[model samples]
Target: MEPLMDRVLREWRGKRVAITIGSEHSFTGILEDFDGEVLLLRNVVDVVGNRGKAMIVALEDVSWIMLLE
Candidate 1:
C-alpha cells in the first residue's frame, strides 16, 4: 500500500502547487517530480518575492502542500 503522502504527491504531480517547507519558507511552482523521499519543482516563485528556475525539496522537510488552481 502506498503511503498517504505518496498518494497525495502523485495527485499533485504535474500540477501547480504551493508548499511551505518550514515556517520561514514557502514556494509555488509546478510539481515536476517526486521519488518518495524528495520532490522537484520547476519555475518556483515564492511568496517573499523570490523566484527560481527549479528547486529540489525533501519530503521530510515539507510542512504542507496546497494545490494551486
Candidate 2:
C-alpha cells in the first residue's frame, strides 16, 4: 500500500483541509505543502476561529485530517 503521506501529497495538495491536533485543537486551511514531518497550510483558521494566517503543523502532533468539501 502507498504511504499515507504520499497519498495525501498526491491527492490533497492545494485543497482545503481540516487538521485535528490531539483532542483540543483544530485548524483549517488550504494544504499548501507537506513532507515527511510537517505540513504548511495557508489561509488558516485556528480552533477558536482566528483567521487569515498560515500554520505549520508537525505530523507527529496530528490526530487526523479531513478534506473540507
Candidate 3:
C-alpha cells in the first residue's frame, strides 16, 4: 500500500493547510508540493496570520499539518 503521508498529500494537494513547525512556528498556505524532504507552499501566512510570500518548509522541522480547506 502507499504510505499514509503520500496518500494524504495526494488528496490534499492544492488545498489550504495549516502547518506547525517545531514548537513555536506555524504557517498557513496553499499546499503546492512536497518532495519527501521539503514542502512548497504558496500565499503563505505566518503565525500571527501575516500574509506574505511563498514558503519552503523542510520536512524535518514540521511537527504537524492540518487541512484548512
User: lDDT per residue, candidate 1, 18-57, as tens digits?
Assistant: 9998766899999999996888999999988898999998
* lDDT measured at residue 41 in model 1 versus the true structure, 0 to 100: 98
Query: Candidate 3's residue-wise lDDT over 1-69, tens digit each?
Result: 998998898889899999999968989999999988999999999988788779999989999999998
List clashing residue pairs in candidate 1.
Answer: none
Model 1 poorest ten-residue lDDT run: 2-11
The lDDT for every candidate, in the order shown, is 0.90, 0.88, 0.91
Q: What TM-score against the true fold does each predicted structure earn?
A: 0.89, 0.87, 0.92
Total backbone collisions for each predicted model: 0, 0, 0
lDDT of 3: 0.91
Q: Per-residue lDDT of 1-69 in model 2, one digit per residue for the tens?
A: 989677966598999999999868998999999888999999999888899778888989999899996
lDDT: which is higher, 1 or 3? 3
Supply candidate 3's per-residue lDDT for 56: 93
